[model samples]
Target: MKKFIKKIVLFLSPCFLILCLIVVADPFKVWFNYDDYNSAVTQNGEHVRFKLFNNNKDKYHFDSFIFGSSRSHAYKTQEWKKHLKDSASPFLFCASSEGIYGILNKLKYLDNLNNPIKNVLLVLDEHCMRGNSNKKGHLYISTPALSNESSLEFYKTFVVASLNV
Candidate 1:
């Protein structure tokens, strides 16, 4: 029993150290000022991520949303809104090397918003999908109502990824 315990500890030690490193690196700290802050919040704690989510129904609401990895960061929300000639929300929930699973996870958050989303623009980054073939582009499909399948699948993937790291 002691030997078995020791082996388990040895195997998990490196993983624990890596997790500590990541937390100390503070990836989210620097990103707070990036697109994440802009899209998710306004001057105060007011949520500005979606123009049509709740308060500003009388005015124009965001009919479209952008979904993609960090490479998609190059596309600015104001520029996209101008180009499309429509109110569209730009999401920056993606990270480097993120795959379809990441995109799906982000959509799950939108699916829980108070207001409904009408359209979504998913950016396809070539490098992320290079070796992935079984990609089902339905990761970003969402409904206003919370989906049990989507929630469970997303949480499952998140837990697995977090631990596997």
Candidate 2:
């Protein structure tokens, strides 16, 4: 039994170590405390699917935003730019199964960016209104840190989701 326990520990220790390392390193910048990360930690590794608008808000000087689920992906940004004939470049912030709460969270993050939001294209679906707003067990990938909620439940959700990732 002693030998068996030792072998199991030896095998599992490395995996535990790697898990901790991932939590700290956070390559995708989706989970963990990014505040500890310095400029040396590459911001370019962010998962762009749901985070594009938040990650690159300053890069495009975007005045317009498109927020919705995966269905909204078909609406090309350039098409809207041509239709509006405005200087504001469109940024599509969409993800699979994105709901109303997720869209609201994105808008909140955009507002926090402190840039003027002149135009918004919101493509929504029927499911958005039926469920609880804000979150549904890591269904969407947007950062909870953006919400500025510091309660245990908030931390629990993020940490649990991060650990799952």
Using TM-score as the measure, the top candidate is 2
Clashing pairs in 1: none
lDDT of 2 by residue, 1-165 (tens): 999999999999988897677657665455533333344432321124435555565687878878777778789999888877567788886755667767776677767768778888988889756524554344443454444454455435545665665
User: In angstroms, how far off is 43's CA in candidate 2?
Assistant: 17
Residue 147's C-alpha lDDT in candidate 1? 26
Question: lDDT for every model?
Answer: 0.45, 0.62
**Candidate 1 wrongly placed segments (more than 4 Å):** 1-63, 85-87, 130-165
- To one decimal, what is the Cα RMSD in angstroms of model 2 from the true structure? 7.4
TM-score versus the correct structure, for each prediction: 0.40, 0.63
Q: Ten-residue segment with the worst summed lDDT in candidate 2?
A: 41-50
Give RMSD (Å) of candidate 1 vs. truth: 9.7
